[model samples]
Target: MATDSQLATWEVFIQSKPGANYIHAGSVHASDKQMALQNARDTYTRRGEGTSIWAVPTSEIAASNPDDNDMFFDPANDKMYRMPTFYVMPEGAKAI
Candidate 1:
């Protein structure tokens, strides 16, 4: 009998252009950072889709709990001034 073990999981982020935001592309499995980067690039940018790539260990990323969405995100709703409705646009100004 043979046993198979998977490599450590890494989270992949890709930027389509310079100065663009790096979005979550997908995940890859590799034993080290360099390998993780190569795997991420090969798997995600096969068609030259990305200009830059970032690979981070899955264990190193901290994410907010989805179950506590109201507790974490609802406070912004109380600040009405943050909304753009209070501002009056000048005549002939294009809508942003």
Candidate 2:
């Protein structure tokens, strides 16, 4: 039950290259998916900056509450195997 004045918010993601990750570019307000895609392109990719674009409705996104960050992320801190501190790098390995 939305009015014409109350456009839905859409989150825009842009990929710079074919194999690169899609990064959050910005957002736009539109009534439908097609409009959202066009608005996102016009608003964020004017310079041909993106190889691909994705426009997702803001209402569809689910996010963790910041207030629960400690409880949510605490388990990972105790998992030592998650970190690579014990791994010895081979000689001449530049960035591993």
Candidate 3:
């Protein structure tokens, strides 16, 4: 039931250090999550390119709805104090 291109894609992320941010490494195509993980490891970490790795199937992710854009971003602009424009920079300080 699965075509070659229909084999799921898993996004590969790598964390170089314990506290560093995880970065998108690449993607893998496999029949299932388990296989995807193996493929991701073989394809992405062959040379110790990463200290840590994660493989997430692209379909399993649920993202914000584009239709809710207004409500999603409205509150952030309501509070103006969060901006640094109100205060003057200290003496000898470079322009922010």
Estimate the TM-score of every prediction: 0.77, 0.77, 0.59
Which pairs of residues collide in candidate 3? none
**Per-model CA lDDT versus the true structure:** 0.92, 0.91, 0.82
- Candidate 3 residue 33 Cα shift, in angstroms, is 3.2
Better of 1 and 3 by lDDT: 1
Poorest stretch of ten by lDDT in candidate 2? 1-10
Candidates 2 and 3 compared: the better one by TM-score is: 2
Residue 82 displacement (Å), model 3: 4.9
The regions of model 3 sitting more than 4 angstroms off are 1-4, 46-48, 82-96
- Ranked by TM-score, the better of candidates 1 and 3 is 1
Instruction: Rate residue 4 of model 3 by lDDT.
Output: 60
Model 2, 7-68: lDDT tens digits are 88999999998977899998899999999999999999999899899999998999899999
Q: Candidate 3 residues 67-90, lDDT tens each?
A: 898889878898888888878789
Error of 3 at 62 (Å): 1.2
Scored against the true structure, residue 48 in model 3 reaches a CA lDDT of: 80
